[model samples]
Target: MRFHVLTLFPEAFEGPVRHSMLGRAIQRGLLSVQIIDIRSYTHDIHGTADDYQFGGGHGMVLKPEPIFDAVSDTLSPYPTRDRHAFPVVLLSPQGRKLDQQLVLELATAPGLVLICGHYAGVDERVRTHLATHDISIGDYVLTGGELAAMVIIDAVSRFTPGVVGAADNVQEDSITSGLLQHPLYTRPSDFHGMTVPDVLLSGHHAQIDRWRREESLRRTLENRPDLLDSADLSLTDRAFLAGLGYVGISSLLDDGFESQE
Candidate 1:
């Protein structure tokens, strides 16, 4: 897959795109990142891409003309049908929160056009008329969308074929799995006072699997209980969690979890 990043600061992406798995993916021709300077599309002498808000806002808003023109010029070579289905994502705090599901969805697209909003934010027209997806990395705000665009690229790239070492491992990742992952342990079974779980040392695959399952449940219950609401649970899994005081969804079905009842 290909990612066309539209940003005022194209230089910010140089280091990131040349290192880590993203770099490896590019080296192997599995993925590609093209950085486009929004300023390059501006018609002004100074290449002005941002301007003072019309309603007298505190910060300057990114102009719509440059962004629209940039996107048009970037996708001009693609077929008409392909351009219509292309994803033009705008990074913003007010957008839908990014998650593993969204990353997976974006991976299905042949390419992505990411617009990095800066200063106050992108002009409203870009959000309403041009962008197909408006996404936020988290609830917190950032100084610019450059970092968020990198994050989206990394997250979505992991879903691309051959990007990660084991493609199936991505599915079992912490949030992608729909629950927190189980603890991981490597060589050196004994680390001072801490020791690896005995079940892991044993050669019993069934027992080891069971231990991992329960550990994952235990960790999720302690760290993120909200995930339990939609997590896939079996009778054995529910019973295991119930012993640890986690209320299963089925148990709450009769009363609907209302404390009064």
Candidate 2:
């Protein structure tokens, strides 16, 4: 798959997209990233891409013309290349919360068009008419959308078909299961004062599966209980959770949880 990024600081992406899994994916031809400098599309003499907000905002808002032109030029040959018009994703704090399901969905898209906003934010016109999706990494605000775009690009790219080491491992990831992942241990099974769980070393697959499931539920119940609300619990999973003192979803939503009913 291909990803086209529209940003004012295209140089910031040079080092990142060339290293680690994203780098490997690009090298292997499993993923492709094209960075387009929004300033390059600007018509002004100074290559300006932002202007003072009409209502008098504290910071300048990203101009819509350059962003629109950048996307238009980037997508002009998509149909001819057997690629669909990729979803235009605007990074914003007010957007839908980014999650595993959304990552999975985007990983499967033919391509992605990411617009990184700066200063105050992108103009509302760009959000309303240009972007097809808006995503937020979390509740807090960042200085710019570049970091959020990188976060998303890394997460989504790793799951794209041939980008990762194992397809099955990717599918069995923590959030995809709606539960925290079971502990992982590699060589030197003995570390510090801890030893690897015997079930893992015993070559007993059934027992290992059971242990992993129990541990997954336990970890989820402790660390991120809100996950239980949407978890696809099986009969065994429900029974295991019940045995661990989990009464229901509401009882686990908050940290230091307590139930009245």
Candidate 3:
């Protein structure tokens, strides 16, 4: 897959794109990232990319012409109307919240073009006419969108084939499976009076799997109970959770699990 990043500060990406999984993906030819400086498209001697807002905003707003030109130039080689064509996404707090599902959806795309807004924000025209999607990492705002773009790239890249060392491990990632992952322990099974769970050391595969599933459920219930509403739960799983004192969804609704506070 390919990713094109449009930002005023292309240098901001140098460190991240050159290290870790993203770098390895690039080396293996499984992923490609092109950093395009938005200022490059500007016609001014100063390569100006932003200016005062129309109605007088507190900060400068990204100019529309340069952004539009950059996106158009990038897509000029492909059929823009095709569904398989790359997506032009703008990073902003107003966009749909980024999540595991969104990451998976973007992974299916042939490529992505991310616009990292700075100062006040990108002009509304760019969002209305150029971008195919607007995405946010979370509820909070950032000084700039460069960090958000990097996050989106890393998360989406994990789903690309051969990007992660063990593809199966991605399926077991926290939140990817709609639950927190079970605890993991390595060598020194016994340490400072703390011993590894006997089930893990017993060479009992079936029991190990069972223990993992139950522990995952217990952790999710304790840390993020809200996820259970949409989590894939079978009858047996529900029975097991009930055994751990968690109210069944049906019972919760029927009796109204009111907060003691």
Candidate 4:
């Protein structure tokens, strides 16, 4: 997968994307990222990318011309009419909240153009005409969209087949599986007074799998019970959750799951 980031502060991306999993993915040719400085497209001598709003806003709004030119120039090489044509995404607090489902959707794209909004925000024209999608990391605001773009890049890359070492790893990821991941313990099974669960140490694969499922449910119930309503739960799973006093099981049934009882 390829990601093109359009930002005024292109220098900000140098460290984050060039290290960790993203770096390794680039090295192996599983993914590619191109940072396009929005200022470069500006005609002004100072490379001015923002200007005071016409209606007298507190912060400068990103100019439409530079953004439009940058995106158009990037997309000019590809057939614009195709379904797989690169998508232009503007990262803004006003956008739909990013989630596992949206990440899955973006991973399928051949490439992505992420517009990192700054100051007051990108011009309305940029969002209305140029951007194909607008996405937010969460409900809150950020100083700029650069961090959010990096986050989307990392997440979407995970679904690009070879970026992650194991296919099962992607499948079993916390939100991808619709539940919080079960706790993991390694080495020093006996620490202080806490001992590793015997099922994990017993070399009993079936019992270990059962323990993991139950723990996953317990953690999700305790931390994020809302997930269980949409998680693909087996009758056995529901029974386990019910036994643990997860009262939201009724909502799951209302969504059309057959009651285990």
Q: Each prediction's Cα lDDT score?
A: 0.89, 0.87, 0.89, 0.89
Tens digit per residue, CA lDDT, model 3, 155-237: 99999999988745888989999999999999899999899999999999999999999999999999988888888887667
lDDT of 4 at 86: 77
Ranking of all candidate structures by their TM-score, best first: 4, 1, 3, 2
- What are the runs in model 2 whose C-alpha is more than 4 Å off? 80-84, 249-261
Q: What is the lDDT of candidate 2?
A: 0.87
The regions of model 1 sitting more than 4 angstroms off are 251-261
Per-residue lDDT of model 4, residues 181-254, tens digit only: 88888989999979888889999999999999999999999999889878888878877777775666575554
Sorted on lDDT, highest at the top, how do the candidates line up? 1, 4, 3, 2
- TM-score for each predicted model, relative to the true structure: 0.92, 0.89, 0.91, 0.93
The TM-score that candidate 3 achieves is 0.91
Which candidate would rank higher by lDDT, 2 or 4?
Answer: 4
Model 3 pairs whose backbones collide: none
Q: List the residue pairs that clash in candidate 4.
A: none
